[model samples]
Target chain A: DAGITQSPRHKVTETGTPVTLRCHQTENHRYMYWYRQDPGHGLRLIHYSYGVKDTDKGEVSDGYSVSRSKTEDFLLTLESATSSQTSVYFCAISDPGLAGGETQYFGPGTRLLVL
Target chain B: EDQVTQSPEALRLQEGESSSLNCSYTVSGLRGLFWYRQDPGKGPEFLFTLYSAGEEKEKERLKATLTKKESFLHITAPKPEDSATYLCAVGEGGGGNKLTFGTGTQLKVEL
Candidate 1:
């Protein structure tokens, strides 16, 4: 909830459709991450960006892709949505250079439902 | 692989009741352990970070303690407003900032 904001807080999509979620941050932190939260599975990281255009996959990267064109924006794309991908998505920001930067601050989160 | 496990998936307590939540972890290097409180429909808020065994941190009504294999979140004289899901996560050294999290424990407090 720091300065992070995720767009399309709630969305309902159909299977096989492409879905994109946006994360915007005003904090301009050096790191950004995308994670999905589901019942019983806890929160799994999808991808992360250390800097603009420098991205890497995470624990649950399959079926999900991420792009960061600007320092303040990170986007998560579900190439072909599936019911299994339906979950609450959250974006987080951090900057290790700052004190307590090891702690990640999260966005409000975006809830997606795939049918 | 780094793994975390939390006990008592759900717990119900009366106002002013004191209790403890447990989080156990298995990870190499054990960089840090974190505790977070999350309300329904909201992102998790950071609570405490324990860097080594025997270290303890405290807030108004919550206290977090760390051990070699696990961490404990102790709530003393809890209030109804303290109801929420408590999440535990661990970061391993040289793990590139990735954290392994537990499923979390849901707490419900009634007046």
Candidate 2:
């Protein structure tokens, strides 16, 4: 309920197809992150953006890409989806800082299924 | 490598039962520790944030305490609505805005 919304809350697609997910935030936070949640892996960061057009790769950035063209919109793209990428994706926003001021607010999440 | 481990992968408690979940972490420099609750098919919701060792915070029937190497999330007289996956994360010191999270402890409260 942090004014964050993810589009296509659920999706099912075949392998080798391209997929893109969108995360939009109304709060206009400075930091944005994309993460994937798996059963045993917890939540792994996929990519993060510090500002519009400024992005960095995370621990598991393989086969995935992200773009932040504006302050409120961040997009995650899968060049060629695979069954291994089937998981719940979450988007988070936070103010620019560390320690106590860096608490992240998460969106509802997108469940992706690849066959 | 920064690591966080949560104990008791799953816990079942009767309504009004009090219990605690543990989160142990190892990081270069501990900037802050966070507690989150995530329901099934939903994103994690922030519950508490502890800035340093010996720090504590509470909300409703939940309390979070932080130590140098570990943190505890104590639930008092839990209700059925308290059932969810509790996640703990550590934010490293300096300007690293990244967070390392634990696998989380799933708690189920029944009447």
Q: What is the lDDT of residue B62 in candidate 2?
A: 99
> Which DockQ value does candidate 1 get?
0.77
Q: Against the true structure, candidate 2 has what lDDT?
A: 0.93
Clashes of 2: 0
Judge the docking of candidate 1 as incorrect, acceptable, medium or high.
Answer: medium
Q: Which candidate has the top score in TM-score? A: 1
Q: Model 2 off-target regions past 4 Å?
A: none
CAPRI-style quality class for the chain A–B interface of candidate 2: medium
Chain B TM-score against the true chain B, each candidate: 0.98, 0.97
Candidate 1, residue A109: CA error in Å?
Answer: 0.7
The TM-score that candidate 1 achieves is: 0.98
True lDDT of residue B84, candidate 2? 100
Best by DockQ: 1
TM-score of 2: 0.97
Q: What are the per-residue Cα lDDT tens digits for candidate 2 across B1-111?
A: 899999989999999999999999999988679899999988999999888898899999999999989999999999999999999998877663888899999999999
- Give Cα distance to truth, residue B76, candidate 1, Å: 0.4
